[model samples]
Target chain A: MANITTNPESAGGSLTARALREGFYAGIVSLGLFVLFVGLETTQNIRNELVLRQRWGLLLTFVLVAAVGRFLTVAYVRPWVAARKAAAVARVRDESAPDSFFKRNFNAIAIVALILYPILAMLIFGVQGSLKWVDNFGIQILIYVMLAWGLNIVVGLAGLLDLGYVAFYAVGAYSYALLSQHFGFSFWVLLPLAGILAAFWGMILGFPVLRLKGDYLAIVTLAFGEIIRLVLINWTEVTRGTFGISSIPKASVFGIWSFDVGAANNFAKVFGLPMSSAYYKVFLFYLILALALLTAYVTIRLRRMPVGRAWEALREDEIACRSLGINTVTTKLTAFSIGAMFGGFAGSFFAVRQGFVSPESFVFLESAIILSIVVLGGMGSLVGIAVAAAVMVGGTELLREMQFLKQIFGPDFTPELYRMLIFGLAMVIVMVWKPRGFVGSREPTAFLKERKAVSGSFTKEGHG
Target chain B: MAPETNTATDTMTNDPILKVEHLSMRFGGLMAINDLSFEAQRGEITALIGPNGAGKTTVFNCVTGFYKPTMGMISMRQASGKTFLLERMPDFEITRDAKVARTFQNIRLFTGLTVLENLLVAQHNTLMKASGYTILGLLGLPAYKNASAASIELAKHWLEKAHLIERADDPAGDLPYGAQRRLEIARAMCTGPEFLCLDEPAAGLNPRESLALNELLTGIRRDTGTSILLIEHDMSVVMEISDHVVVLEYGQKISDGTPDHVKNDPKVIAAYLGVEDEEVEEVIEEIEEIEEGGKH
Candidate 1:
């Protein structure tokens, strides 16, 4: 964050001097650390009747890199960055120029990639191997993508920071679990049922607390989430308490096709296909793919409607929204219900995918993860959230394959142990680097002949 | 559509479009407005002028249904031969049903949205209908598309009026302060309101901007046939555009007449140009005495 200023020459002079001072100070500090590190390790080796290890070369490497890196950063990197920023400002006048070919065609490319993802996965990993990649990475990330998209309608577009969105997910999962277990409702029958139930609960939870705003709203929504979890835990008779509902029926296409093990009506046999169970994973993959697209489609459509504009307006200024005749109560409630409905859809899929429902799956951590995806992606950005979800969820799942690290850190080293630790660190690094997410632009629902991206930085305070 | 039935008597006038009959508002121990009454005739700019904290904004809030009055009624007689109680309605209904729109003392445009979107949001009630409450719109239905196009047309028309058509796609926040003030009024006008309440429309405007505002307010009254209720401390704007003037002090109507009459009214001058507490008492006494003498 070296700010650009008018007098670049003078500023550059001062910057170099400061860099030299910093480098000198760092050099002294590095020398002290070097002696301490070498002396302590060497003394231990000497006491243990071993050769006193002298690692001067390694210490010198660290010292040189630190001093030279800081000097180079100040002398060259900072001024280069400042010059580039000035050039960008000059380029703003000629903004009628079209975006680069790749940037303009990015959406079309992304859609094509999504459509061909399954076949590509199959080709790369073969049939059986592709199932893990599809189910663990593709389906898993898409669920979060859908969750983030749903939450985008609330936190992103609507500007309501809903921390406890997982409550709706739990509501959907339990709805499908309970309804299927007791009433014998099929997946098709209960799928919409789960969504409706979650939506109703969203309204119930939203009504009382919609008046609260910002931190107050966040706190109340959080309490609502904890209440749902407590209800599930305490109301053991209905939800089976902490033990959870097990052996939940798998979801199928119209109840005729299922992925059950070697059943007479197994989907693999019914379709007269191969006996591989990867068929089910592939189907689940496509199922989630369809569902995620539906979520994105609905969100894009809603953003252009009066209701959607009302939500953005309310987000910008509540007082202004009321004066303009936008029914804030209706707008907020609709956002909550619709967002929760999508959460429910994803939740029901989660239940059938796992073939079980448990309180452990519907924890506060889950809500935090979904919310992180939305924030780390751009708020109200459909593609941003999808990319963020893939990076976060798929990346975490990818950690399981890092067994090669044992070569560096000994045979006992395991990478999975530090997954969350690394994830948290990465989040901090990213947020500090770019306070706004990757695509923090507010694209107006209605525009003239040309559509321009309005950076959120220019947006009024309360709205962002 | 409903037939106009003259209710219990409000002795202000026979045909004023917006009538505030003895409206009062109190917050905690503060009487923000006390028994204030005014009438804004159809297609005329009525100015509400007062010193700071005179509760002019409070009255606007009451008429717009942002604050329900503690006493009395605000009524609007729309062209449909229907009279709606403004105080009884909810905030949104005042705009959607009563067809009354307002701008704020401080500009409150949706700064994140484009200048065009702000106008579209003003026509939310109309487009929402064509959207069939969103289902048809989601399906990309023809009716919704036609309505959306129409709403954009309306937005463009207002942007042209505000001289901001070029910045239609620019974020509302990016506009200069003067342009933003004009955009606010234009956004309110896009609602197709019969009654427009502008709170300090010229609050922070420059000389040229203020002149433009005067012309815009006058044009709205003349061309659109929309009655404007303006609250302004800027006397130049008040003197230029207003057809009628009501002066408030201590949350009481101190002077009520034409701009010429109210400008020379000693009580209004004493209240605005600064007066001692003793002089204020005298002005109130003079007003009450004049009110009683007129009644007799």
Candidate 2:
């Protein structure tokens, strides 16, 4: 058995090595292109006026570089890495060693990388301006990550298809918005209140669907989400209809400084620095970061609890879950409510961050994006969701900066136009290459002792 | 181990654990169970046997709260004299509150979960109730931890009883056919039910596997004091394990008595033989005479 496994690994390793070599060459070519772009931008006067006007050489060169880069990365780099890992695993097995050399080395490197990430980012962009990366990429994605994990408890763990997940998020956001706007409640007071309100809505959704199953349940939940959005859109008196509610209150730093109070006793002023609007952004960054971490921690803990296991069982088979004396209705309700509660948390955080709330924010597209994260990442896997969110959200954000591509496709080329095309291509490639997900294993939050990677076949297909 | 000769005064002889009083179920126009009345005694292996579509499964479903009866009632009295209206409760509450656990004709283990996890999930309600799902419990509260540990212990205990401790970590779906059936019963037992209803528990088992299953059911009845309501087609299993038997034909009770008595009944013979009812008595009498002549 061991020999059979090792044979495939060794074969895979050689393939990976070849891919790595190709990737190295592609990197060199891209670097040369970058240098050419810098030269063209700086030394325009040195070239003939006709040469600059035609620009055929630059356009041709840019296209060639992009084509070569893509070819090398896909045809060689990806396969090479996969083969190398496979071969390394085979070698470790042949030697009968517990921990491979790479595993031990990678752990140490990861620890160092994590420790230096924030410090290095601060140095590169300045602490105040670094808020963009921390907020947009970090906190924004983390909120979705939390929402995905919560949804996993329902759709992934309990096998309950809940399309109305955004309803709970809307509930939480509205809960916080209404309480603060009407009664002058603080962020601290409304955060839990939002969760409770969302949970209440979750139960409301759960009750009517107690007898529903399969596609029927899905349609009902989908309708429920649309209903919530329509209500927000049409209820002009309270929600202000499609105009939306603006100038919403932002979360403060323990009431240390009013955001509108100018630089006089502001948070940055206490540190003897000029208070920029970026100060508030940084504060919001850390606030959502903490909330996201708390969400992950709570979800992890819940999986080990009886209710968590019940949810998994329910997911596997409702008949068996009931036969085991689990109240299926209650278990389903708990999963729906708990998942909704987290959605609420993320929704409320979104409202505060943007300082606005609108019906458009809770559209079906948002639900689709979040669901894609869960499916693409591998259901019930926390780290997978985080990586998936980064890939989907960060990839789109990165597309906006591809200015070099504009020169190749002419000035008419807009990167955003190809965003959806690239996104769809990436999804198809991932699905074909790794159908069970990038991280295809059931990583239960809690276990008896040491955790091991259980195989991925147990979960729904197209998810981990 | 004389098989407990005190059966006359055992729980089986006292107030019946499950009493199906004139229960009838209809699907549109066809009556699945028609005026079927019988009592399953506690600590007794009672078998419900007939040919296919004899309403055995329907009766079991109605009793377990899976199907609502169109007419009649299923009254179950526990040792504490707590009478449960089985038809009134949902399937979940039937298992949780009434302590009525059942196995399906097609074994339905949580195939994705490990063998032990299947049993642990069966004990879900107990652990969840004990923990109260508070924030303290979510924070790994001591009581919650203890309950979780106890659940694992119970799971391990049942896994050992089912002779599946070695395969505890394997997915339930990976088990061989017979082991999967045994695991299903063990999972049901983990729920700590007062009565265990098995739908075709020995449907696909070989002769030896079926005999082993009989021993397991007998042991459950003897040790746990759990009433056994089994719907089986295997005559050997029905004759070997069942202390009482109810025979159904066309959704009605044709015969009800001890296994031997029902086995010899003309009505039961006609149901299995597919003969006219008028010819049943003639065939039974001839068979009895032949038996008597052979004995002499």
Candidate 3:
């Protein structure tokens, strides 16, 4: 709409005037929004009474920044974008141009990079220094990538908005924790068991909500998540309440090699290497990388199957799907169970890696973060979700290592304090710039002579 | 009802592909369809013509199992003499088991899917069974691969028939209006339906496109021996293609006969032209005098 209103051929003077007016409006709006938060601060004086302190100068500075930012964006960025768009339109594009070497082998390159991530980190930061890099960044980002991919099947392909997806993750985690603790089951035995349990719960959630759609479905799923968390918190006899299950056994390589330092069959003993915690982190990293790849592989393969097509058809239009003899009930349920299955896999991995399970870890915020990763990565695109997970999860983790910021802010400012604020601002910018996420185009699951990417405009977000 | 003037070529009236008996559908206080009964003979194009709001689509909804009739039975007897009660079955089962396929008045294609994919979805039941309910398919088994290829072949056949072979890989939503309508019909054909019910297949088509649609429908009837029942306001299409016509007015069957018989029926004429109860007789006389004058 703004594109239509702003004429490219406007007089130079008028353009500047318009930009100034728009900048002033933006500044006024920002002032109104920020005055209470920035202009005044509440403090406890020596007598322990609340006192109000004036920060008008800081408020003015913020207001001036907003004004200048708006002015520069309107005057420079908009015109530059419009000119680039015009140039692109004027040029006759070569539709059949071959892709660059990097573009053609992007997936292979990414896989290779992921396979070598932990080893590369060790070479760069050495043993102790690389533990934080590998465990905190590599393992952390991969877990989110797996979770987001799982949720993508439900929300992206099936177009079912599941607000309480973390419930399934919790189910998987707790299933592994309790079953292994009580039954003395190995991590290998409980991994698939956890997935099956989560899928069963997915079906349990799927049955009653079959008749519901849109906002109604979202609300029910949200309530279901909260219910699971509350149960975990209050079920003290089984779950240990808020104390959580602690000192859970670490995962092993098919019961052959354990990650423990003192275990007789430790990975270091088997490999004839020196004892180091980095070995555990590296092993866990590879395990998660394999699991994440499995999720991607299954999802991609399923998209080409009949059930997968039916899921997408249900997303397109339920009435039409029914008309075509596609059973929507089974289609939707399959999406739910399959999506939950992956979440379960990731949750079990999380439990093993952290050596604990707790209801607090499976909060609604986890679901929101996973969902945002899917949305920000462009729904239904595997590679895009991985990139988004790295940027969001790894980006936030990177903030904790910003020791240089202490020098600039007089050793008082903590970059982590502004993490959420920065995360939110980045989200807003991305949504405005690329509403369909980074990779908007859809690759057809099955193609004939030549495969063509379906434009974002042709796809629907779906009502479910 | 007008006298039965069903074509001599299709005299097997005892064996109708579809039979709707005493079907009535009520929406709250509005009687959308009142005790409507009609039979579409095997291997013939049957047209249900009516003025707007005469409950033409409501009857279709009942037959397709989208709306269960308040009171009545819709029986579809396949060629093998197997009878399925469509009204009792669920919407998908109506298509899956009864082998009854339908197109909507407003086009409802899987717009995001490719044109070929839209057709493959209609063959979902067949391929699903061959895939061993997707277990074997997911494993990339040879049997499932062969079945998938066969399904694609069937889709390609229909795509060629619909003159949409060129756009098979494009998203269904990206096609032109006429192409989308034809794709819907093509998708319905992919279901291998014993009885096809199309609601306003030529609703927004121009004359040339309508002519092409006529050819497609006739070719389908000739080649596949699939029975067709359509509701259309385009008299040109109804007159040119349909073997029998059923006319409705205000939720009641006003006329039923061959196309020529229904075209000459005074009730159908008045229904389309909107004449008052008292003025109907006068208009009938005016139509008769005009016909006599043309004869002279």
Candidate 4:
């Protein structure tokens, strides 16, 4: 309801009084929230008895920080944004402006950059130093980008609230891990098999909950996720219980070249490069990037097809969809299975990357994270979800390297411990700032004369 | 006054395109419709007019396969002599296999989709086949490409017919109320239905819009030979375009005849005007006098 095109003069007139009121309210709210946690600390005495130590000074500083931040945001930042918005409104009076060269060619530029990332990192930081950037940041974020895009098919296009998408991811990972270990199958063979198995599971989940919509569907999916995790945990004869399957084989270049450090056909020896593990990390990074791009390409292509339009129509109005001769059953199932297939691909890549598959890796929290990435990125927008994954996943991974924080909070302080808190705060900020998400407008699947982006206000979130 | 005896069999002796015989729908203790029987002729607009709580929409639901009737049979015969017992078919098959499409009493366009896309969705079954269930389409085969182009052309044809070609690219939700209603009809037409059922198509339209709707419905009948069965409270629309009118009250038909015959029926006058038995004759005479004075 925050109107970006509001008159700037009125917005600027009440800055002081409104900011003071808002700041005062923020101070009170932060006081109430931080009272117990920041005001008191639990510590053990010499005799090992628990005691509550008061930290009133720390609490007061937190409250004042919150208040001042709120005050500055309201008085200065809001007015500046309002004025800028007004100027923008005047500049583009009736029609949207043409895209700049950078904006138009953004995808090409990003793809080129991603393709060169591992090589560039090795050139800049050497093999030993480039491993973390290639493996931890690049590979990890691409896996999530793929997973989020997969879930977007169900929750975004079809309007199905599937809270158990991690189940498919788990199925994919476990399929590769179990199959490779038991049958000695290569990663290349197991990847497509894993996707098929996961898609099968997706249809199985889709069948029973076909009649459900909205919150009811979400609850069932949440339970389904837990069920898959629990099955993996208890099926000791097959899944190895909580210990999981380890030493999962690494993926190769179509089973022809291996990235193994010591094999006869190893990548390093064949290419006459040094025997460093960085080559494997670089390989994994490219592999995941290719997988992510495949997901994006397939999704973009599907959006223009009839099945995809049917899914969207089913979302908009199921009754109307049926009345138009669309088979809702097939439409819903295709969305579920296709989405699960991508999750499966990402899962197999995950197993190959970590060399492990366990119930601990596929939790409800993981599903929530992937779903949030899809939502925060603007549900149906591939670019938005990818950017969201980078910011959220990469941001958390970056927290581990914040050794400079020890200078202020002492050597005992770990920024990694506050990753969840920072994540929660970021979600809140995004929701408040851009509720429709980073790229709220929808790109139409088909156009007659000209393609126009449908505004978020004109688009429905869908009922089921 | 005798419903079954007054059936509109005298006007057109040809087989009815749609026949609902002894149809009844019951929700718990309440009978929404009981022993309702009517026939809609091929390529003609048949109007179902009823007072409040007369189960007009419930009857439509049965005919459109939204709800299975509790008793009796509703059969639809296409031009090719292929007959479908609608009550036995699923809702989508009624539209797909039976070639029967419908618009809701409340507008139900895919609001998030563009005006053109709304029509494209109606052509989903055809394109889905041509796309080889998307395998061919994803590969961008020439077959799929041609199908896609033809579907868009069909959607454009409907858009032009509906007078919505100008706003074909805009989101359906952004259209005005009248435009949205027209878009819904355009979308339904894209399905290529032989029988189209409209539930309260003129419910909220202003007089001018209602007049425009009358033209669209009549034009569809004239050009496409698509029979229309519409439920309407707009007397002007019903009186102007409908070949036959069926009147209902308290889930029972009171009159069935040509529009003029039904309009002057004393029983219909009592049911619609809510007059007592003795006042029915007086009300009919008053209506005749008004018509005579207006004629001059």
Q: Give TM per candidate.
A: 0.89, 0.83, 0.88, 0.88
Worst 10 residues of 1 chain A by lDDT: A38-47
- What lDDT tens digits, residue by residue, belong to model 1 across residues A152-270? 89888888878789999999999999999999998888889999999999999889988888888888888888889999999988988999999998777666777777568898788
What tens-digit string does per-residue lDDT give for candidate 2 at A33-111?
6545633443345563434334446655665566567657766677789889999999967975577676758635643
Recovery fraction of native interface contacts for candidate 1: 0.85
- Candidate 3 or 1, higher lDDT: 3
> Which docking class does model 3 fall in?
medium
Clashes of each: 0, 4, 0, 1
Write one digit per residue (lDDT tens) for candidate 2, span B1-296: 11365353233455588999989999999999889899987777789998899888999889988888999989988877899999998888899899999999988887777777788888877888778764568766688878878888888887777778888777777799999999999999999989999999998999988888988888788778888899999999988888889999889999998877897787788789877666877889999999999999
Each model's C-alpha lDDT? 0.86, 0.79, 0.90, 0.91
* Chain B TM-score, structure 4: 0.90
Q: Clash pairs of candidate 4?
A: A159-A464
Worst 10 residues of 4 chain A by lDDT: A1-10
lDDT for predicted candidate 4 compared with the true structure? 0.91
Pick the winner on DockQ between candidates 3 and 4: 4
TM-score for predicted model 2 compared with the true structure: 0.83
Better of 2 and 3 by DockQ: 3
Model 2: which residue pairs collide?
A: A12-A83, A13-A83, A16-A80, A19-A76
User: How high is the lDDT of residue B128 in model 3?
Assistant: 92
